[model samples]
Target: MQNKLLGVIDATTHKNGIEDLITNRSMSAIPFAGRYRLIDFVLSSMVNSGIESVAVFHGFQNRSLMDHLGSGREWDLNRKRDGLFFFPSPLKEPDSDQLGSFKQFKQNIDYFYRSDSQYALISNCHTVCNMDFESILQRHISTHSDITEIKHDGQSLEMYIIETSLLIDLVQNEETTGYRSIVDVVRDSRNTYKVSEYEYIGYAALINTIEKYYKYSLEIISPQIWKQLFLKDRPIYTKVKDEPPTRYNKGAVVKNSMIANGCVIEGHVENCILFRGVKIGKGTVVRNSVIMQKSQIGENCELDAVILDKDVKIENGVTIKGTETIPHVLRKGTIQGALMNS
Candidate 1:
């Protein structure tokens, strides 16, 4: 990616079937891998590739998204010139609904105009992968394509690079009802425009539902995938937490787990992802679970194949178990005991 290339991230839409995790925040803000949000993967990829000018379009309950991406300084996106720009929701009418990226982009066309970039890289924040967008941009420029899309598993990552003029034309005339989405415009214009495809030979993912989320979360636990995504040459950056390292008490027994900082373990955790400030009380058992930030599990509690959202509290004497394909989910700030099924 060159300095002339600008990045645009779609963080406005709501992802269905993930209501439990995305009720209060955009899907991009969803926590992942103990210490990272889904957006970090994409943002880091762009920043690592030397693309400084970036815009994150946000809506549908975006306070957490705002807090998480303050100033974009962490990713080195806060700069003198083309730096991080956030386009907030513009649907302020009484009857207007929550905004989406297309509308947000249309309203903020001045950002694109003043950017002076010849090309733009557009992507959704849901896919969790570490990719070199420079390759994608090179292919787009070499092929002289109007739009070059990256695909994996027969579906577009919703990642594309387009000539800025073509994007302007498509978006400027998007007054009709049928062409609200970028996909729709690209599809409808295929006959008139030159569209190309580049297969991504990396760990491309689509985590839309809870089951898929749980499945992918566990899949990354594989050392190969973990190394490829997080520990590669270009590191994945996130908000720095200056907490101390995790502490394991005398009775602690952890195996095949990824534990982050600010955790205290006195029980057993197997094949789990423990985020910052999580506490596993003595005698508690966690297997095949993902416990997010600041959650606590009381003693004698047993959790298997579960996804506990942030700030959840599980009392003692509870055993919550679900199958591998369909893990039970406890929503954010939930308090659970023996009777609660969530």
Candidate 2:
């Protein structure tokens, strides 16, 4: 099922507000579910769909991306030919106007020219879903489309499967038009290029805003969504971690939560997602929240609709509450909680 396919994860753009939760990491590297990054969905979807080659364009804090993807072996992308490639942007550019996304593509035009794949699947690490791109590839071939992209509710997911030659032609023809981004090209291509759109039902969360992020993080609580995301045909792969099973002490109580490995729970957790290495001290009560890796929550604390970023420390007897619509967020590595004694 090669279909002469090549994948390009065009995730170099910045997503505002997500920086508030994590300052030193790219959005693609932000952990999701229990143990996966946002990029894991896109990369896994592609790899599960039989893509052998992928190129990730890094925007800022690329070190985080490098740390997560390492050798691409987790996704089975380490190959002698047509594996993974990293394209890094300079720390400082001459001007903002010169940093157009199309300009970035023009700089890396040799990659597309050098590849023998007939089709280029351009995607972003936004939508979190398990999907197979094979049907869309077949659709593109059957329709003889210059570009075939997926759309949900009349919105393109920024994942386009276009003919490689058409992409090269677009790059060559739109060199100096001050093109803003690839979306601009596709938006205007209806007139110049043959374009086809397929409806996609893969939107479990529109995570551009904090509210959406919080909302979608809890969507996994649903039996339908959980089965669709994890128990489906293709497995979502990520960097493996060797840790013992989550330990729930005699007094610990868990209800409707997804807790990962390396967690020690001695309190009560309800409707939450806990990443690895989290330690919930005795007598704490947490509800409707997402606590990331290595965070420590002291005893007698009460939290509702909160998102504690990785490595956060919450002291005892403190209370933090926010609505599910707009959950309170603690940035990465921030320490919260009152230094109080019972």
Candidate 3:
């Protein structure tokens, strides 16, 4: 079954609602769950499903995505055989930035043509789930369906399993057929293809907007939610950073937070998720926030319901607060000081 299936991940779509966090990175590379990127969940699922050859199609803002998925070593896809392949879209402006984009796929049609796989598992990079594509493939085969769309609670997860030949055919004749993407083909009533849906009962979160991102990030703080996403046998893989254990200094009071490695906490943190190498200075109080990698919060500062990007520095006595619905977002490399706020 592994030899008969190929993995294709679409990482090019950009959401206007998520613009704040994606200013310097693609949606797929957005930091999540303390140490992993949004793409890690889907990519790891493909690898865990025994799909050896995987291709990631990305857009212009691909520096961070490329850097994070360099050779796909962390996912054990760095091999001499048919391993991880990356294809950047040639279009400076695509006709449409949708999942299973045929425009981008048309740019690298040779990849689909040359593969020996019988079927393809196409997925979006931003969906957070620990899925087994093999199960979907089995159902597709048993049902004799042309396209199998995976859904969670009757909502589309934007994942599909289709024959490789049919996928190539759709990409090749997209203009003639007037089909922009897999969604278009599936929606068309004139098509003879048998479309099916496989209900996914597991925990799945699609991080497409700021609200959903913030909601899911905090939701995973619960052990029950994180347990569903991170399985013992099928673990999500990410670029490993060798960092020392997190240190909780004297006077630090943390409750219900998830802190990654190489962190130094001397402040009070409650219901926050701190990524790798974050520093909470003495006398600070942080609550219900998602702080990314290497961000430093200064002494006596207070942050609530905020999302700080990587390398953000909150200076002494800075007080920033926002609601859960519209959390304050500090872009990457930005420094917020008390004087700035005053």
Candidate 4:
């Protein structure tokens, strides 16, 4: 029998809204390792697993997302039966603006249950990695887990410790001890006859659980409830692969660091997280900067920590450095200082 899987793309705010202020954009839309946006990883993974139906939950500041993923044809997700679907937050009134991330997510849950699919794969765009959901779904079936979470072990403690603590406190009672790490909380949350190893990759596999507990309940639920439902017993299993850890392209020379994509380089590059389609002019010495999509740098122009927004241009001999700690936000054009949206 063919199993229906839904890939839910969570295009939420970035860490406490810091990145959002700069770009006023969704994390999914954030420019990453050259030539690939953050949402590309999740969307590509779904396509790789033969999942054609996807619903991307887009909230605030999604114009760029709409522009980049127009019709979803590039990823082969544009189809009549199973293709990419955009689920934006419902407006309170006809004239009202978009809702927050959590509000949009709750609406997505409603959309998932209304569908004819059996399983749903909920993912956030913050993570960057490769995943095979077909294999993961098979494991979930064999284990009969109501909810399965995808997890990674190597994340820094400082990054995940507080979130893990909050999860434990919300899901478990006061008597629950030894909740030192996220692993401990996962171990305690299982409601099955036997425990299994399942890494919580901050992603989840829900089998009709959204309908059972959440349908007709409320438009929005607490994070605690979300965590409790996520931890529900069944047979949570982790699909760990010994693949080579992701690395930057060799030909691409990054001087100041912050390179993300699997980019291939043929020319010299310095100090930039060159988001995909960023072509460097030969002998271009880009110092301390972020260059967004398809921006071309002229040869010998020195850029220091400059935030070049989408489709920006820099003429040769243009030196923009030491403006401020925060890089100058340059929209489309050959800019020298800051270009604020007016």
- By TM-score, the best candidate is 3
- Model 2 CA deviation exceeding 4 Å by range: 90-100, 176-178, 202-204, 339-342
Across 1-342, the per-residue lDDT of candidate 4 in tens digits comes to 267666666554345323422255665665543345556756776777666777786666788788878887777777877688888755332111111233344444555545666766656654544556777777766886554556557432111111222232323432355333233334465433233334546433221111211111121133443353223332111211233322434454555444434333434665456655565655557665666656766666666656676677676656676443344556544444223211
Report every candidate's CA lDDT.
0.84, 0.80, 0.92, 0.51
All candidates in order of TM-score, best leading? 3, 1, 2, 4
Which candidate wins on lDDT? 3
Which is better, 2 or 4, measured by lDDT? Answer: 2
Candidate 2 vs candidate 4, TM-score winner: 2
- TM-score of each candidate? 0.94, 0.93, 0.97, 0.56
Evaluated against the true structure, the overall lDDT of model 2 is: 0.80
Which lDDT tens digits does candidate 1 get at residues 34-65? Answer: 99999999999998877889998876578888
**Cα lDDT for residue 140, model 2?**
89
Candidate 2: Cα lDDT at 284: 96
